[model samples]
Target chain A: MDEFSFINSIKQHSYKQSSLIKGIGDDAAVIRQPTQDIVCAVDTLVEGVHFSRQTMEPWHIGYRALAANVSDLAAMGASPAFYLVSIVIPKTWSSGEINQIYVGMKQLATKFRMDLIGGDTVSGQELSVSITVIGYVERNKARYRSLAKEGDKVFVTGTLGDSQAGFHILTNPGYYTDEVYYKERHQQPLPRVDFASKTENISRIVFNDISDGIANEANEIAEASKVSLILYEKQLPIKDSYEQFPPKLQHKWKLFGGEDFELLGTVSNKDWNELQIIAKETNTPLKEIGYVDDSQSNIGQVFLHENKQTYRLQKKGYTHLK
Target chain B: MDEFSFINSIKQHSYKQSSLIKGIGDDAAVIRQPTQDIVCAVDTLVEGVHFSRQTMEPWHIGYRALAANVSDLAAMGASPAFYLVSIVIPKTWSSGEINQIYVGMKQLATKFRMDLIGGDTVSGQELSVSITVIGYVERNKARYRSLAKEGDKVFVTGTLGDSQAGFHILTNPGYYTDEVYYKERHQQPLPRVDFASKTENISRIVFNDISDGIANEANEIAEASKVSLILYEKQLPIKDSYEQFPPKLQHKWKLFGGEDFELLGTVSNKDWNELQIIAKETNTPLKEIGYVDDSQSNIGQVFLHENKQTYRLQKKGYTHLK
Candidate 1:
């Protein structure tokens, strides 16, 4: 297909949004300016670096790419509004495969009513999809990593290491008995947008999304906040099936594996119970993983406590530049 | 450098904007939302496709990518407010090269006070830069390709074929005498944001930025606006230097060459002189190239008149896909 036809085909996926005054037919998409504070983030998934052709279909790649950006907005307790995608396609991809990609994004975008407004489609040797999402948040209510304080309790939504475990299962199919659950997790890990919106009532919180594992994410919050975090290894929530793998392999996945798409952060001790109540009402898994401490090495550290032994969690995960 | 440190280094490029509440240190960039109607667009440039390493430097590549997106905003008569760049780096690119890229973007961004907000940095096999820019335009005042009508005078800003001539000079050095002028045009083709802003007071006009030469852009307006355009060949504006090339090459560059970064569209006859005055006051070259016509095919036709011979202009230029 020509570029114009490709663009016109994707327009079929765009749903009517009151805020958008102009869409595909214009030089640029025009929208009624928003009045609420808005947060925007971009995430790109590249072939080989992010996903393998052996493991992922075009549909899931699209879904995962959009979800990654939405997860960032969710970390700030924002509601998704609009998105634009810039995709590089290799000639090896079929036209049908590309159409499936848009269908996949449309499925996830409809969950939050995100309107696709603009994008760039170009040919390249490798496929890469970069999506930018814009979402609304209340001015002072938006959360940030630097907002965490000494007395706050660290919390995590959903189970840790689930996506990595799922990815492992996808790569090594028959080795895991429960392939369905793990494979689905790998394919369509949901962004906690609803959970974020539910917690918007809280006056203050420090939030980060579990994109590059707790080790890296925790370090980000700790470094940005200029405080330290301590996690009880026994408190980490993981699926029981993790025990089937070798012990070191099992342990490493939870602490260092990435792409969980779950929310991780700190909240006031008094507000902790209310958060759990909201999680329970919404049926989202919630766990108290650790606490922020001023007594620890204060220039931003993360320590893990297991079997009466404590050690610093290595500050690394899924870095593109090293 | 690790991802966090790499992100930290890019922090130096982020300038402060009153609308931006958070920048490099946050999970997502947050901004005090705009109050006027806003328009956004994205453009991507892939290595070997948009530029050649032998001809263009890293700095000019960055400038060209961002300028492409700003030109879209300019076409809509929007004032640029914010921009985000998602760049992919190949293993061959050094850190200093990447820093130079951002420096190139910052030079043009500072011209219109565009702020860098949020983006993704990832590793890939080929270098690609995708830039998204958001701009403010008054409600119902923004221009569109689908707004031209019969009897509207077709106009073009700046000169045509200048970028193509410059690009040729760069690739085939000693053949062209005016290297400085054409080379600058190819390296830093300015977006018509200023001219667009000056003409924002006009009640009606159709505008399309000529990134894909006038043939493609004029055809786009004709197709989108459901009209026809007839250009007088003698009225086409070009530098006297173009005659140094072969006659066919000279003619082809003006009609089919891309990357001029000029503006082309139609204006009402009564409003025509005012546009010329504005262009003159701003020292921007303006020319009346053609007129919208109802006598031709209503299904969007473009025709060129030369030496008592009139023929159709091909509907193609610089498309990434077949």
Candidate 2:
């Protein structure tokens, strides 16, 4: 697939967002002049660190890069306008494969009304894609990791550990051939960019896209904000089949295994009710898994069911170097 | 080096520009509301395609990625602000080596007040880096590739083939060991970001960053704007030492060797005197290489000698895929 051909195929069907004054094929893509504050985020995915070449498809890789960046915009309480994608391809990867990745990326871009703006392509030793997404939020509406205060309630969008479970199913498809729900959930995880935009009532919140598992990102938010996060053992949401795994590994995978691409956010107790109402209107479950506290002043320790029991969260969130 | 460590090292010396509201350690770097239009551009460098892995230093690699993107923003007549870098490193490269790369990036970022903001780190099969730089320009003053009108005089900043000549010396250090000027030119290229901002009387201009050599980018401007560009071959700024190479290889390298990262742009004939004045003030030479014309409707065919023996210019510029 020629680069232009792949890009053209993507432009064939897209959401017509007015924010992109110039999208793709220029020195830079121009956006509608920012009326309010603009928020931008960037993320990169490489072959081994982010995805296993043996198990992941090009389309999944492409879709995840776009979905992942969009999730950051969502977490910021911004609407995505356009994204710049820089892709480096290895000789081993066919242009057709790269085109499939673009197809996946375009699908997400269209759904999010995020135009694929300008980017660069260079020959590399392995397949790597980096994307910078630009979005906009009303002035002062952006949620940041530093915004969480003591007593803020923690909430999560969508099901966690599903992507990790999906990875297992993807690698060992025969293990769950009889269970279609298990396979589908693992293969196609949704990014809640649209849903999160509706939660405007959750004011003065802090959030992160749950890429490095829920518990790991929770620790980051806490540590970065200089507060402590406590997740109740029973309040944690888990799929029924999640219990079938070896208990330690299952918890480890859910807590640290990444690529979930969900959103973990905090809001005041007053706003938490509004968030629940918003989630209900969309027919999606919003789970309250934890809360922030000023007392401990450390991050990522879970409160256990046994009285006064606690578990130290590992610093083993996905490190790019590792 | 650990990704965070390298990022911190770079951040320590990075200058904070007045336009940058936030830099590093965030989902994205935030820019203070620009008082003018923001011009943005991105560029990538790969180990094999853009530079030789065996010859180029890690710091040089880092520098070029940032420099090339800065050149693009400069071509649009924008002032550099902060930049977001995306890097992929091979596992074989040592941490110290990667740290030096960040150090090199830090040097240039400090020089230009372009903070090294959020980026990605991943283990890839080879080294690759991509940078997106955002800058500010008054909306009406922004230069574009489509703004060149017939009779516009094409001007180039600095000498062109020096980088190509420098590359040859880099690959074969023993070939011209005594010539420090030639060797240094190849190892370090200065992006003309300063030129675009300071040059006056360049309104409604068309230009591009000459990363892919001037001849090739000249063709791109011609193609994009649907205008014919005529080169005054006698005015070609061939360096004296470059004459030592076989005339064919030397000319080929000058025409096709990439990574020059200079500015090739056009302005009205009336601005020629003003350009010369600015060039003298800045101690940088601006040469009149050619002009845009509707008569020929072909790019780069011109008289080779003062006597006017015209020859066809080949579009033998560097192409990544080719």
Candidate 3:
């Protein structure tokens, strides 16, 4: 079974719906929305670059593709819908492993009610998977990345860099691997869809997923929005195991390492309490990291104050291409 | 500029319409289609597996990705609308070449009005381009590969094996590149979108694109439709250059080499003249190649008779894995 056959077999078990005009074999899967418009996104994951083929599980590989793309829709304040997947795998890979990947993707798709519309398959030297997810959002309520303003408080969901810390645990056993929090955060980063829908007033906030780590993502928002962002170094959230590391390494990994997939947004200071309320209602943590500043900031450098000394925090982020 | 920057530049130039809820920068680009369902498909072209990176221009590489996916949509009789692209390039390649590829895709997208949406870019050892194209089709007009019957006359629009001929011309040069008809067919494939749209009575026809040569595609339709297909050797149309080749080589290239991207369908005999009328109206040729037969009668073989001897055509079709 090639990748195409594996996808087909999973699609074969999809619940038949009249709204799906065409599914799983065309250029695109056509899903009808008599009263709604379609929301969509595309994500690509490559072996060695996105995941180490030697250590990555087929299920996790499949799960992350769906999760990462769906998180994009969530950031846009949209609901999940159908998706098309394109996969290229080495011909030598077994069909059984490919099937397990689909099995993993199907678990998520089923939970999310995502229709596996259509995609293409071909043989290649390395594994590459690209998924285009289509969802729906009210035209009036779609989110944007250029909405944050001056005096906005920077907000991030859940613990920052937990995923990165999880990576370290998985990679170096001498650090911390047996801890449930670290392992789960690394293997399965939850997309904050529930938190997104609950926070309506924050829709206009500059939003990004911490796939590239909070430090880099914060800088992205600052650069794109054309504002200086001040991250409080001491207030920065770090896993307990991460704190046990040498100060230099801890700061480096937490600030620069990515793969967190957590939501980061900036809201006006006035909405801080309201933001907390929404997070409470959704039972999701919305951590306040710092503030959007007007200083002549040099991109993503953080400010630290320690023992009668002030220091600049340089970017210590993950670099995929490097 | 890197691959990401080049792709980002392409996304930046995409037109923003009210119908497009989200354009780029997110995981996916979301669009609203009031009541119409969307058709989507993806196709990936690798450096050597799909095209020779050394000879093929970047623009053609981009064009082929869009064209191939567009061809798939045409097979489903879906209207072309939007597409997302993901590409991986080697470190040694220049960003200028990558931008040129996007320029190629932009030209096609501009011509077709298919919205250029979102994608991902990464550095890799070999170049690979993947495009997911989305379109819309009425619920009732969508076509598939499972509708052919025993009595259906198999037809292919335009000429067959021209891509293989083109490949030969470009690779070997001494073949057919000298002939204008063969040269253009090899370099610029005219997808049968016009012919596909005119395929009325689609409910009674099995549909697919002839990418992997007609013989291989016939086998695919045969396998999907659970029927055997027989091609009349005399009825197979060829250009002048094809005849110049050795007889055995001519048949072999036409039967096994793929990437023609033409519309190949099988229709009931009753709709034959009507199809011809539609073809004439559209100024496209729908040539009759063979007939569908009982699976038990011939298995998966194409039959041809020369003088008094009957011979079975071997499955010499191009395999991506191979």
Candidate 4:
């Protein structure tokens, strides 16, 4: 379809929010933010690098792009408010395919109660979707990756490695069993927006989303907080589907195969029990797998415990360069 | 360059602001808004479509990307606060080349007092820079394209057609003289951020940025406001640099060639003189080219007047598809 037609079709899917004074159809979207602080993040997913059209549906690609940005906001304990999407599509694609992408965006946007405010759509050689999400949090209450303190217990929400397993099944469709479950996880990740309200009583919490694998994220927390993370491999909450794989393969994926979109965070030991109680009350699975140490020698380091032996992880997680 | 090193190289250049609670190196960027209302807009620039690496420097590409977003904010009459950039580059690009892009972004960011807040860096087949800019405006003061009133005088900032002319020279160097002037205009069209303050006294001002040429933008304003825009050909602000072209060629570029990045708007005839005075005081060149009309037959139409004859424009200006 032509640009005007494409824009008109998606305009029907844009939902209005009270804070949004003017959305879409304007030079810029105007919003009256209810709060003083807002969290912002952006992520771009390109064809061939983030997804393959042959392996995934257009809707799933759109869903994953927004999901990545939502996960970033979740890490900050921010409530999703509005998002802008900039999409570039190849000329060969039909208008229907483009509509499906927005359909996917509308589905998730409805769930999060966020508005599709403003963006640009253009033609390019490769299909790419870039999303900017704006979220809000209470003053001085937003979580940070650098807030993990010595003696804090590291915890994660939900099971790890599911997205990676789903990705494997998607890319190698014939090689894996339980394809539906893994593909669904890979295609649609549930951002931990519920985590913010659930753990409101817990203080001194530092959090990050697991997009670059647990090991790498753990190292990031350690480096930013100037502490060491000692993760117990046996305690990792690997998904049941991932356990079907060989132990080594499961371990590798758990540590290095990123895109899980789960919340990885640390809380002071004093508040850990309160957080666990809240998680249980909220019906969210919370796993404690490590603790932060203050030793300078181990700062910026991640140690893995397996078979009653501790080993430092020397390899970094998945890099976008690949 | 690897993602980590690339992120570090640009981190030093990132400026800090009082409203920014956190900038980069975290789950997301946190900013404190001083105003109750904020404006946001996003745009993406793709290689081969927006610019060619062979014809433009990496820094210029970066500058243009941010400039486009800034222009959008300028149209809304907001003060730019911060911006996020999502850049995708081919793996073959060197660290130095990537650094140059950030250098260009930093240069513009500094001039506008906008901080490079947060974004994603990923690999893709082609280079694309997507920027989301956040700006603040006084409550109920932001301009809208849909606010134009009948009998309102249409005004354009600076001159038009220079960018299109520059683009021609850049693509076909041998065909044009005064290459320096045109090429510079094409490479960097100054965003009219200064217009917001200059027109503060005008009670009923509607604005839009002229990225899609006068004919297209006039039609947009007409359609949005349900009015007709009548243009006086002699009143069109054709740049002196563009005057060297044949009259026909100059008119063609003025009407159909876009990327001028000038402010286009309408102010009530009663307030027009005051606006012009303020524009002169601010040292901003503002030209009155036409007036909004209340003709039902000409609703959503643009009529160009030349030599006492009026003609309708049947063709739209440059579209991304072309």
Candidate models: Cα lDDT each: 0.77, 0.66, 0.67, 0.74
Deviation from native of the Cα of residue A46 in model 1, angstroms: 0.8
- Interface DockQ of each model: 0.20, 0.19, 0.20, 0.21
Model 3 C-alpha lDDT per residue in residues B226-312, reported as the tens digit of each score: 777767767776765577766777877677666778877889999888889888998987789888887686655455443555555
lDDT of 2 by residue, B1-322 (tens): 3323433432423422344333333212334354566666667787778877666787877776677777777777777765666777776887777776777776677677764445556667787878877766664566667667789898787766777777777776675633677655666677776767776365566657777776667776776667777776567676766777677767676666656777777888888777777778767768888888866545433212223555444445322211
The deviation in Å at residue B178 for candidate 3 is 4.5
Looking at candidate 2, what is the lDDT of residue B128?
A: 81
Candidate that would win on TM-score: 1
Candidate 1 at B117: error in angstroms?
1.2
Q: Provide the lDDT at A136 for model 3.
A: 70
The digit string of per-residue lDDT tens for model 1 on B1-322 reads: 3323433332324332344432333112233455555567778899989898887898999888889888888888877877777888898987667767777887898788776655667889999999888777776667878789999999999888888888888888685677798999988989998888788778998888888788988887887788889888899998877788878777878888878888998999999988988898878899999999976544587888877877777566322211
Model 4 per-residue lDDT at B44:
88
Error of 2 at A231 (Å): 0.8
Fill in the DockQ of model 1: 0.20
Residue A20, candidate 1: alpha-carbon lDDT: 43
Superposed by TM-score, candidate 2 places the C-alpha of residue B148 at a distance from the truth, in angstroms, of 1.4
Docking class of 3: incorrect
The TM-score, computed over Cα atoms with residue i paired to residue i, of candidate 3 is 0.80
Q: Which RMSD does model 2 reach against the true structure?
A: 10.7
Query: Looking at candidate 2, what is the lDDT of residue A220?
Result: 65
- lDDT per residue as tens, model 4, B195-283: 66456656678878888788877887887789998888899987666777778768888887878888889999888788878787767
lDDT of 3 by residue, A251-305 (tens): 6656776777778788887778888898899888778887777665444334444
**iRMS of each prediction:** 15.5, 15.3, 15.4, 15.7
The sequence of per-residue lDDT tens digits that candidate 2 reaches over residues A52-151 is 7666678878887788788777777777876677787777987667777877787777676655546666666777889988776766566667677888
Off by over 4 Å in 2: A1-34, A175-185, A241-249, A296-308, A317-322, B1-35, B175-178, B296-308, B317-322
